[model samples]
Target chain A: MTDDTDDIKGTPALDPVISDSVELRLARQIRELDREMMPERDLWTAIERNIADYPQRKPFNLQGDWMPYGVAASLIIAIAALLVNVVGLEQRNSTLLAADYAIDSIDSGYVNVRNPMVDQFRETNKNLDQATLDDLYRNIEIMAQARKDIEMQVRANPENTKLVEMLMRVHERELELLKQDYSQPGRSL
Target chain B: MNRALKATLSGVLLAFVWAMPCYAAVDSGDLAGKRVDLSEAAKPDGFVKISIVRGDLIVEGWDKDEVSLVGTLDEKTEQFIFDVSGRDTRIIVKIPSNNTSWCCNEGSNLRIMVPKGSQVDVATVSTEVRLTDIRGGLDMSGVSGDVRIQKVSERLRVRNVSGEITVHDVDAYARIKTVSGEIDARSIKGGGAFHTVSGEIVLRDVTDEIDVESVSGDIEVIGRNISLARGHSVSGDIDLEIELIDDALVEFDSVSGSVRLRLDGKLNHKFDLETGSGSIRNRITDDKPKKSKYIRDEQLRFTVGEGDGQVNVSTRSGDISVSK
Candidate 1:
């Protein structure tokens, strides 16, 4: 529309106003611009009218509205990642605890209970607050001590089959506990 | 070309591919050049061992003056092997070379047939050992393949890793140590010792002493008539059925699996059973009475058969049941 006022043509000194040819050309360019922009302008007007009449107006002032959406999407992703990581860590911890128990109990073999692996595993996994690992370690210690005592008693009473049998029972119990620990499951982590 | 001709050509090509191995040269050197043929005059010897470097070792005992083995070593393929040499007094077989390596070119399988009274010693790695109808001691060491023996009388000793030991009709002692494999022994007339890191031990119709120690896996013993049976496992069940003779002593210990002992009424022996958190049940005969102790209110001790031989049983978290 403003281009109509700036139209100047013919002899530059002849007139301060636009000449007929220049005026016509300017008018045509303006018309073409309007023709190109009319649909977009109408669509914008319709959208503005719809938003004005919409029942649910935005609660917050929508200055830089995409900021909130981006924040929400980032929160969702963070939550999903956290959940996945937590679940994975829990599973790993579970398997690790089981394996620790098995190794401590000597379920794989005759464990000496003095094995450093047991201590190292307990110390490392204590953060998970796994009571089983501690319990297993303690039980293994007790069993090992019992085995030693029984062996001593048997040696003292070599001829006494009854005492020897009782001691043997103790030894058997120790081995059984070790096996149970091993057979249950392995460490997950 | 016609479609029929093309089809026939394809069929022939397939047949040729399949039959390639059959036509391929099977070097007898893989057999350790050890082949034993039985003679009508061959006599049963005390012991026999044949160590070969290559070729199949085929041993068949008979009534004869001497044991002869013909070696057919191929000029090619330098694979390791050991086989039978000669039968002097007993059969003494050794590897002449200092080669400490082993090979399985002929699928590494040794089929040995000895007389009913012949003893054998086999030492190989990664070769399946098959022995049948031998009456003397059978010593085997360091094998990585499956070991199968049948009707072998005398002591059988096997030490290896990752191999199954199957023995039948063993008249004497049998001791085996394996890393991870199943051990099945049946009709053993003497004591048996089995040790494994991870494996199952199954015994049937065994007499004399039976001792087995394993980290895990169930132990099933049926028709056992051993005077002393001792089994220990870290985490596995001990399932047994036998007659506890007057002089028999049976003990089984496990970590978490139940101990089920089924005994004959004729079983006359004492039992000392204990477990951490499991119950113990002992069966008594109508003829002979029994006495038990709940001494300390936790430990259970019992005596039977005039309190002769002792059978100790223990476990950590499994029940001990003695039933007829």
Candidate 2:
């Protein structure tokens, strides 16, 4: 695809062309180039044939273009709805009985609310055996079950704010278990 | 060489590696077993950590700046160590982690002595612990054993799975936890938190603010004047007989456990007691409880004799009784 001017690079006489101005080089190159390029064979006939053989796109139809867009929009809405239900409904249904003062004492134990020392504990005990890890997880499950029991009681006795406060305390214990340092030789489940 | 001979040698090596116990010290000095008199020189205000799987552990704080371990190793102990490095000391007994026979004789009964100012941390499994006269902070955990503490003047934290925990003359900030073990503390100063599951919690002569949570276990805090006290439980009765300070704040919440408070002072506190399906008995004053118009609940709110302190108690099915 390159022109014969590609050979000018290694020519000794053209070494000085590198120092020439851009306009001068362009003028000289243009003068030396052919006005038109023609193939030995008639390439226009092949071009025409290829052009006629290539398939043409169909006329624009809203059905094909809008279908994917419509599907994408519906998917976005569905996911949004699912997220709202999962998060928002729980917040709505929750009735926390503990006062902010009471909760502040328990919540201050861990700075992280969602994961709380889970990553740190796992990273610290990367060499822990499977059985030890299983024991840790089993204890966590037991605490979680206790918390779940209180939460269920909260649902049944919504009138009793005491139930709600008790649930909060149980939840705090579960968090403490999650935050326990299993890597420390002084660990106790 | 024959392949069979190599296999036998390799099997022996594997057995050795499998039985190797975990033991390490940052900079241990001297071989610590005066099993023959193993003692190590340690800093007075240093740290000591002890771990065992079973047997009795008696730790005492002494004026002498030394850490010593005196005891016989258990029959199944794969490794026994009393390591001291700089200000840190570790006394550990490791048994085979994969042993089939876990019956008795898995750890050692050892008495460890550290400087009075040295912080102590002990972890055990079914090993009874007796700690005394440690002015430094204490952190202890037990799987199933009785833990007794006396004259601990600094902060203390104890956790046990199933055993009796008794603390006497502890004047530090403390937190004691037991899953299925009874806790009895006397003359505890500087308020603390107590937690238990299906075990009784009894605190006598405890001062300062206290937080208690229990599950299916009774909680009793008797003979004290506390500025603040908070308690919560599920199916466990709570009995508090104490005097409230002028600005005291006491709150008790229970699902099915009854809450009874007896004030041993002049009546000068506001009380808010409520129950879903339980009666509220007020004996400090002659105020009749009001019934909730919306639900079948009872509410009693009264202030007596220039009420300066407040008491809030609520329950789902537990009766509330507060008296002076």
Candidate 3:
């Protein structure tokens, strides 16, 4: 063994040792190692006490959060605004449609009121003279043409109140003519 | 007994004298295309009633204090009866009771001149009746004949079934009705009811209260100082250019025809307008309308000036336009 220990510039050096037999070298290394290592003390009881004193935690849920509530509130406000707008438009449209329906109802009522008068006149004046009857019929034809013309105008303007009133007036006139002719003083119906 | 017998004989003598012809130039010959002049003494303010079956009847006011009939008769017609007694004069072109088959073909054309300020009542079937420059009330009715009256100063009542009625310069109340003939009246100082079935009614310069009703004919009224104007039409357009007097009321009702009202520039009225299924183009006000969400009809209620006059217009389906 060459000398392996050397003192270099005020520092101590260690000698290098080598072993040929594996078991004898391991025994020598084990004998040279320090064996005085110890574990820390056990605090299981204290940890258990601390854990028992602490408060319990609940499971997290997205619905219980403030952000979800804010989003839901905003959604409700938006839907309400949209509903108000829709209702306003619907009301405007319904008003116009209702007016049209009323006009049609009035026209139907006029027809109902005029038909009976016409029928009664025809029944009473069945034996009127040909010339007188022809005169009455010719005049009635003129009235009918006027009515047709008014009706055509009404078709072009369905909402014309004057046209509808004139139509009723025309019907009333026809009835009046029939009634007057049948009720004439000299006429034997 | 003697006194009673004498009284009875006197009564018989009086009856014989009354039965004699009072005025006897009663020409009974053929009067075809010939002027038959007959005059009868009458009071100044007496009444003349004329009846004809089928003929053109013309009555005019003259300065004379007598009633005269001067016109031609149809060749086929035979009898013309003129009776004047006391303050009444009656003229009739008699169609014999056996001649019931005669139409308007056989008739007379009589032009009777009555005293001024006389109440005249004339009736004819299928005869055109014309009355001019009459000072008293006129009551005339015709069937299938046109009636034209001008410058009548009293109440006028004219009725026709299928004949046109034209009245001009009527100073008193005028009531006219026709079934299928046009009624053209102008310069009517007193307003009355004008009704027509299918004939157009044109009224211009009519004053006082007027009521016009038409079934299918257009009504055009250009009235001045109209106190109360009520117009009701079924299907005819009403064109009114009216100047309402103080505290006047004008009401117009229509079913489906448009109404255009041109009010005078000095109109002070409260306008109440309503229309179904028609929009209002109001130039009267610049304010926005108070639209009801439930009722779709257009309504305008506004006051103009002091609102002394009222204008009420209602329509079922027609537009109402009012302008100054």
TM-score list, all predictions:
0.49, 0.65, 0.65
lDDT of 2 by residue, A1-189 (tens): 134355465556765545354447678989999999888887788888888999687887886688888889999998888778866656545533343333444445433563546666566545434544555555555555566566566656655666666666666666665555443447633
Tens-place lDDT digits, model 3, residues B1-324: 999999999999888776544434344555544667778778888888887756688899998988988877654445556777788887766454333345445467888899978998887767788899889788887668788999998789987878899999998999998878899999999888898877899999999999998767899999998899999876778999988987899999777777888888577889898887766656666644455686768888999889998999877677888877
Across B1-324, the per-residue lDDT of candidate 1 in tens digits comes to 799999999999999976553333222344344342322223466456544323344444444434443334322223422323344222222222222222222422234445556666665444455666666677765324577777666578876445688888887888877656688988888878877645688888888888877655678887555688888766668898887667877878766678898886465667677776677676653332222353221345666658777777877668888778
* DockQ (Cα-based) for each candidate: 0.01, 0.07, 0.10
Worst-scoring 10-residue span by lDDT in model 3 chain B: B95-104
Per-residue lDDT of candidate 3, residues A68-182 (tens digit): 7888999998888777767766765575566557556765775576567567666664444355556767876776676666666565556566666767767766666666533
lDDT of 2 by residue, B1-324 (tens): 689999999999887764442233221323222242467678999989888766778999999998876776565655666677788888777655543434534346778888999999988766788999888889988656689999888789998766799999887988998766799999888889999866799999999889988877899997566899999988899999987777788999988889999988766788899998999998888999999775679999999767788999998889999887
Candidate 1's TM-score = 0.49
Docking class of 1: incorrect
Q: What are the Cα lDDT values of the candidates? A: 0.57, 0.75, 0.75
Sequence-dependent TM-score of model 3: 0.65
DockQ of predicted candidate 2:
0.07
